[model samples]
Target: MNRILATARVQLAAWPSTLGMPWLVLGGAFLVNLMVFALINTSNEDAHTGGLVTFYVVVLVAYVVTMTQYFPMILGMSVTRRTFYLATCLMALVQSLGYGAVLTVLELVESATGGWGVSLPFFGVEFLQQSNVLLQLLAYAVPTLLVSSLGMFFGVTFKRWGVIGMYTLAIASLVVFGGLAVLVTWLRWWGAIGAWFADQSSLALLAGWPALLTLVLAAVNFLMLRRATP
Candidate 1:
């Protein structure tokens, strides 16, 4: 247990990229959107932008770096693969929760300030609005976990199999998704799929399904890392 925690601390040692970069990117996105939205002379009071996604993408990229760069270094230092994987998972959970709490608080502040006086709904977008604070936090955090796990998966694939592995994974994903798209088009199931998504509440859509997917990806990462070379 102590070893796992130590490995997590080792990962956190690179705090600039892991802890700082995402917020910096998010702040930049917010400022850019705020400026653009404030400049526009629209009478619509419910203006919203999807600029919040920048933070998540940045975090995902950071974790990919963790796997590609940090994992090999940590493993070379006598840490076990199991320890490294556990440490990564622990960091992911803590980071996701911390980020979620910050976002939730920001959303509350945005609501009170009338979207920073421009009625710009950046954090408190309509689709993610939740009356229950805990649910809202879960909604934000779950997707973070999902993306972090995905990044870890990519890193693990690279460590295990290199560039060829990444290309194979990408091609496999395209084939699977492309085939699924063709099947959906043939079956005319796009409407049903859209309806199914439309029927879900915000919490379920953002947190519930994503929580399941995160688990699957986390499990896959664990298994892959077990056999991964550095």
Candidate 2:
């Protein structure tokens, strides 16, 4: 475990450690979330609709951005592709947990102050004090993992500066949901990347399928990684 962790750390350092990207993504997530909370509370119908857009956009950005950091870093390393995949998976889990922790705190504060209500599916977390903490965490985890796996695939395919694809995915997700708002719907091709994090039902089904898919995809990544000339 320590070796893997150490390896992961070393690999991470090889890339630019500027706080710029991390801050940009995290700040964007929080800012978009705040807007959603405000919008949903508004009585305006437009606000309500806007809130949904906000929600999907934030989820897309958060998932893609968090996973983006790990993908290329893994490939840039001298490690085996399997090891790289495992490392990316572990990193993704940790990143999701971190975001989940912060989001839970925000939901609680909102519920208590009547600022903006946050709810969870598995548990009825309508109020700050009554919110289902575990449920809240899992709710966030759904999209996080979904984005991570999909982002990993992107990263494995495009090593250096691959995070650019994450940004593209985020923008594309925003466009899809936004387009749907106009009632002029089209095929959601790129949003499937966002689907890793934006699934609305049957989380167990979602998780099981994505996890299996990630393994298969990661195996492919491993093969590609082995053949990749460093």
Candidate 3:
């Protein structure tokens, strides 16, 4: 437990760049988005903006780089794979929650200000707007975990197996998605699937699957880490 905390601290030591920079980028993008919308929003319709969504993409890239850049250094410093993996998960969880809380607060503020007087829906998507704070945090946090786990999984895969592994992973993903598409078409389940999704609450749609996928990816990341080199 102490070792895990220690390792997490090491990871957090770079928090300024890892965590702070992404929000900086998000803020800059948001300003630009707000300006664009303000100028063109003649209708004054509170439309959904894609600006904040890019934060998740930033997280994906950040975690991938985090793993690729630091894993070797941490391993060389005598941290075991299990310890490092646990620490990475801890760091990701904490970072996600922190970001989620801030986003939720900003969302609340946006609501109060009526989308900052521009009617731009930057943080408040109608589908994801939850009255429950906990659920809202979960919705925001779950995707961070999912994206981070994916980055970790791929980062380790690349570290352990190089370019060939990435190509294989990409190809495998394509095949799986293609197979699923074919299966859905053959079974005529597209409507049923869409209806099922429609039936589920936004919390279930956003948080539930992401939490499950995060677990799966985390497990895979740990397994790959077991065989990974510094």
Candidate 4:
């Protein structure tokens, strides 16, 4: 347990990239959206900017880079694979919660200010507009976990398999998805699938599945790391 904490501390040492950059990007995106919406319309009606998507995408890339950069360093320091993996999971959870709190606050502020006084929806998107604070937090945090885990999975994959493996993985993934699409089309399940998705609560759709995926990816990442080399 101490070792895990120690390993996590090492990762946390690079706080600017892991913790600060995403929020910085989000703030910048919000300001840009605010300026654009404020200047263009000159109206009182609310607008949906969809700018928060940029922040989420950045978060995903951040985790990938985190793993690719940090894993080798820690491993070379003689840290056990298990400890490093556990530390990464810890970091992902902590960072997600921290970012989620910030996002929740921003959403509340956005609502209070009436979309920054111009009806722009930077933080408060239609689908994620939850009244329950916890749900809102989950909505924001779960995706972070999922994406971070995804990035870590890819990072470890690249470490273990190299460029050729990545290319192979990408091709395999495309084939798998394409096969699934074809199957869905042949079975005429698109409508039912759409209905199933629509029937789910927003929390279930956004948070539940992503949380499950995160766990699965974490497990897979650990497996990869167990046999991985620096």
TM-score of each: 0.97, 0.53, 0.95, 0.95
Q: CA shift at 54, candidate 1, in angstroms?
A: 0.6
Clashes of each: 0, 2, 0, 2
Candidate 2 stretches with Cα past 4 Å from truth are 11-23, 26-41, 44-46, 49-77, 116-131, 159-216
RMSD of candidate 2 to true structure, Å: 8.5
* Ten residues in sequence with the least summed lDDT for candidate 2: 120-129
Q: Judged by lDDT, which candidate is best?
A: 1
- lDDT of every model, 2 decimals: 0.91, 0.51, 0.86, 0.86
Task: Show model 1 residue runs off by greater than 4 Å.
Answer: 41-46
Clashing pairs in 3: none
Q: How accurate locally is residue 86 in candidate 4, as Cα lDDT from 0 to 100? A: 87
| Model 4 agreement with the true structure over 1-230: per-residue lDDT tens digits | 99999999998897887788888888898889888987886564444677788777887888778778888899899998888888888888998898899899989998899777877877889898787999999999998888888888888888888898799999999999999999999999999999999999999978998888888888898888888777
In terms of lDDT, the poorest run of 10 residues in model 1 is 40-49
Best by TM-score: 1
Report RMSD (Å) for each prediction in the order shown: 1.1, 8.5, 1.4, 1.5
Please list all clashing residue pairs in model 4, or write none if there are none: 46-119, 47-119
lDDT of model 4 at position 145: 82
